[model samples]
Target: MLEIVLMHPDGKLQRLEAPVGVSLMQVATGAGVRSIVAECGGSAMCATCHVYVDPAWAGKLAPPLANELEMLECTSSERRPTSRLSCQIKLRADLDGLTVQLPESQQ
Candidate 1:
């Protein structure tokens, strides 16, 4: 299991314990994390599951694919160097302590 720390826009953090191979969206949505709407589920079709990976853990994740990169343009938050679609982030042992900050809105 990996501990994924989700930082809400209001500054609260929800420490989630999830198994490897599941996408971040499924985990967050299943956990009922308020910030992640997951409008397109884990399909990478919507950017509602956007999050900013903690700089400390950012490089550990794979780069976004073309589809995810295209969807990011529609996110409510400005896509920063750390911006990533949660749907594309698969949990793994290497990401045991991953931390992501939710955007102010996912509309």
Candidate 2:
């Protein structure tokens, strides 16, 4: 399993864990974390699952795909260099302990 940490805008931190091969969105939604919206599920068709990957872990991830880059512009928060769609990130052993910051909203 991989442990991922989510830091909310309000300063609340949620530590979550999931088996390898699942998306962070799946874990967050399943854990009943109130921040993620994930309206299109994991289809990459929506940007509601947007997150800001920690700079320390950002370089560890492969860059986002073209469609994910486009969808990210639709997020309810300002897009940053580390911004990523949670559904586009599949959990992996190497990504254990990854940290992300939730936006103030995910509309």
Candidate 3:
């Protein structure tokens, strides 16, 4: 299993363990992390699962694909350099302990 951290705007932290091959959105939604609405599920068709990857770990992830980048533009919160759609981030062993921040809102 891989460990991932989700930091909420209020400074609360949610730690989750998930197997490889699933998207971050799956882990978050499955774990009941309120910030990851995932309106389109894990299809990368919506920005409700948007997250700001911890800058320290951002470089560890692959660059967002074209579709993900386009969907990111529709996020309700301000987009940042580390902004990403959790649905697009596939879990891997190398990503254990990865951390991301939830925005103030998803609507």
Candidate 4:
């Protein structure tokens, strides 16, 4: 299992375990992390699963593909340099202990 850390807008933190080959959105939604709406179901069509990758870990992740970059423009929250669509982040051994901050809203 891979571990992920989520920092909520309210300052609460949640640590979740995810199996390899699953997206961050899948782990959050399955764990009832309300901040990750994931309306597009990992298709990267909706930006509801937006999250802010911890700057320290940003370099470890793959750059967002063109499609994901396009969808990011539709996010309900302010997009930052480290912003990412959780559905596009696949879990892997090297990604264990990854940290992300949930946007204030997903709607």
Local accuracy of candidate 3 as per-residue lDDT tens digits, 1-107? 98999899999988999999999999999988888999987888989999999999999998999999999999999999999999999998999999999999998
- Native-structure RMSD, model 2: 0.7
C-alpha lDDT score of every prediction, in listed order: 0.91, 0.92, 0.94, 0.93
Whole-model lDDT for model 2 versus the true structure? 0.92
Q: How far does residue 63 in candidate 4 sit from its true spot (Å)?
A: 1.0
How well does candidate 4 match the true structure, expressed as C-alpha RMSD?
A: 0.7
Which has the higher lDDT value, candidate number 2 or candidate number 4? 4
Residue 72, model 1: lDDT of: 89
- Number of the candidate with higher TM-score, 1 or 4: 4
- Cα lDDT tens digits, model 1, 29-85, are 999887899988789888999999999999999999999999988998788989999
The full ranking of all candidates by lDDT, starting with the best, is 3, 4, 2, 1
Give TM per candidate.
Answer: 0.96, 0.97, 0.97, 0.97
Give the C-alpha lDDT of model 3.
0.94
Distance from true position, residue 3, model 2, in Å?
0.7
83: Cα error in model 1, Å: 0.5
